[model samples]
Structure formats: C-alpha cells, structure tokens
Target: MAHDHQHNHLVQMLDLDAEVLEDFHRELVGWAGSLVGDRPRVVDLGAGTGTGTLALARHLPGAQLTAVDVDDEMLEHLRHRAADAGLQDRIRTVRADLDGDWPALGPADLVWASASMHHLADPARTLARIRDTLRPGGAFMITELDGFPRFLPDPGLEDRCAAEMDRLRREGGMHMHENWGARLTAAGFDLAGERTFELEIPAPLPPAARRYAQVTFARMRERLADRLSADDLAALDDAAATAAHRDDLTVRATRMVWVGRRPS
Candidate 1:
C-alpha cells in the first residue's frame, strides 16, 4: 500500500505491474549486461518503484539486487513486484537518504544510479561514495535525461516548456545537468565511456507506453501552468490532445548513460 503521492508518481511512469518499463529495462540491462557477472551483487540508488531492479532480475537471473529509496511505500511495492516476478529472494530493499551517509549498501559488483544521481545534494560526493561501495573492478552507471522529451509539435513550444521545466526542477532542488563523466572521475572512478539511449516508440505504442507518455506530458503541462504563457499553454494542450488521439505520435527523449569502474 503506497501513500498517495508516491503511488501517483509511480503510476505516472509505470503500470500497476511495472510492465511499462520494459523498454527502460531493456536499455539499462543492455548497457550493463557485459559488466555484470552471472551472480553479481548490485545496488540501485533512488530505486523508485524498482523498475530497474525488475530489469536486473529478468536479465541477470542470479543477481542479488539491493534497491534503496527514501520512500518506504515505493520499496513496499517493489517487494510485491519482486514476489510477483518470483524474484523476491533475489531482491532486497533499503529506505535511505542518498545525500547523507549511505546505508549499509555494498561491496557490490555493479552500482546502478539512474535518474536519481542529479537529485543528490552533492552528486560528485555521492559518486565517490558509490565507487567506495563497489568491490574492486566493480562497475558504475548513471542514466539521466539530457532534457525532457520533445512532445510539442509547435516550433518554440518545446524550448519554452523545457526552459520552464528546468526552472521548476531547480526550484525543487534538483540539478538537471552535470558533466557526469567528470563527476565520476572526481569521485575516483575510471571512465568507461558513455552512450545515449534515444527512446522513440513508433506509435500505437502498447497501451501502457501510450499512457505513460500521456501522463508525462499532462504532468509537464500542470507543472508549467503557472510559468507558461497562455499561448504556449494552449499550444501544449493542443499537442496533448492530438497525442491522445493519434497513433503516429513521437515520444522522444535522450537518456545519457555514463559508465565508470573502480580500479581493481
């Protein structure tokens, strides 16, 4: 039983069963697969709803995953999800504040910090801590958006919306951009190259994916209602309305993955 706020956010990005994250899971697992051992011990920071955890379970089969989040409700749901996937014994959850000192995490083989890294009070420090938590030769990966998805068809609408979104996120104490490779280096991890996942689901996306996109845009519009101009807002509404009806919609985003490894 998740609290309303936690429940709503998770529902926005994931379906009741975490099925909507299949593509998300695939992208992440694909990048980490070569690095993870058959029985690797892994930790996911900011493991919201455990979407990535579920991905790891399916891919690594034998991976021991520790999912840490500040929200107990999310962790609770993650537990249920793992059980449903018949992976309960392989997944563990920790309620934690990633900004403060980390909890008893790992000598883990892999550290997966997705959209959560930039949310940290000091991302560089956290990255360093992540390195220390990993076993020698352990791997680290941070997946974050370069920007929001471009949904508005109108010229300039995407820019205005993205700018405002940045303001709102900064106000929420989130840092939306960082040279993560540099941060990882500063944190004492050796760089292992990076990749950008261009997420474009040709439309008539499965019902869940479509719903996820709809929720994403709707939430954006709501967040920017106060900051966006009437004209811009109206344009956004038009885009949203059009998106809702059409199957040829373009749900596009760039997710950058920075990989690193602690010296063995």
Candidate 2:
C-alpha cells in the first residue's frame, strides 16, 4: 500500500491477518517486561499505524515511548491508536525516516522493528545506530520474513511464485528479505536469544487477499510486463487465490525474531 513493491505486498498481507498484529504485540510486551523497571525507554521504528507501539505502551505503563515512521498518515493512525489506548502522555510520535539520521532521542532500553527492516535501503547502518541508541545491556529486536508461503495445490506453483518474486527483485530493485541477526552481530550486538515461528494463515482468501495479490502483480507487471506473458500473470493470480482457499493455507511464511544486547 505504501511502497508498491514485494515488501509492501508482505506488509499488506500481514495487515490482512489480524493475528499477526496480536502476536507482535504479545511478543513486544513480553520483551518489554524483561527490560522495563521504573519507567523504561522504548523506541519503535517504522511504526506504521502504531499497532505495535500502542500495544507495547499498554503493557509498559511507565514507558517513555517514541514511535517513528516516514508516512505521516500512518503516524496519524498510530497517534489515534495511542490516544485510544489512553497512552498519549506515554507515547510521542516522530515523523522521521529510519534510513536517515535519527533525531537526538536515545538511550533506550528497548529498540524494536517489526517487518520494517527489509524496507530500509541500508539496514546494517540503521541497526548500528539502533544499537548505539540503546542503554547498556539494552535489547535490539528485529523480525524478518524467511519467505512466502507455499500453500498452492500445485507443487510447482510455489517455486514459480518464488521465482517471480526473485525476478521482480532483480529487475525492480525490490528488497524482499534480509538477515538482520547477521547484521546485528556485525554491528557489535551480542546474540542473546532467537526464535522462529511458522504461521499457516487461514484462507478462503477474502477481499484483503485479493487486494494484496493485485498490488503485488502490479509491481511485477510494472517491470516485467514486456517479458511476462498475459497468461503468466493470470496463472499467478489464480495460484494466489487457490492458496488462499486451502483449509490450513499451509503457507510457509516464517518470521524470525532476533534478540541482541548492547552489553552493559
């Protein structure tokens, strides 16, 4: 919806699945519980719609929160969400790009990015900044996609879908995935813990799924329309719909959570 690319598709798809939001909140709050003592400091990057930020605020009553995002409209939504959660005082929304120089607000106890790092042009540099902003022994958490799901009834469809995404990335300058843990280690973050979760989204694909498919196809078609036959586009859409209809969807979208420390 925002960037009009593969990463955007993944974001829209996750938006379709409300469960992902709840899980992210659960994870963030669980993490905040570990660091929050007497009024903790937390920073959320790429805080679109403020779902994660507001959720974390609900859990960390005494937290001094800063939510940063490039899109003002999304940040507005986050503001409303924070207000709705009665956390207007505890939360402050900052309109700043994560890829740029961060404003002078730091010494955070927790820095979290959910499904946002891959969108950065230079994630390594950003993570290093995040690490430096943290207080001693502070935590840096990043969640990244392992890959798209393979819930297609046809076995080859999954491979074809993956190939299409790969092609689009190479031709369209799309950033679909990343290994933030490796980047964190390179940025001098000690790996404290890690977890992986596989989610099989329930489908019969609703309008939300269709919307996501159309957005993704438009991105691919934008670059490869000359090379991609009309039939190929049709087949991809059909496969997406088919995958959405499956009982379990059996999608293999894996989310990796990496926890690192600033070393007290």
Best by lDDT: 1
- The digit string of per-residue lDDT tens for model 2 on 132-227 reads 899988887777665454554456644655676677665655455566667778889898877777755455545554454444444444444555
Off by over 4 Å in 2: 1-14, 20-25, 149-151, 170-177, 201-228, 239-251
Clashes in predicted model 2: 1
User: Which regions of candidate 1 are displaced past 4 Å?
Assistant: 1-7, 14-24, 203-206, 234-238
Winning model by TM-score: 1
In candidate 1, which residue pairs get closer than 3 Å at backbone N, Cα or C atoms, i.e. clash? none
Query: Each prediction's TM-score against the native?
Result: 0.88, 0.77
TM-score of 1: 0.88
Clashing pairs in 2: 149-252
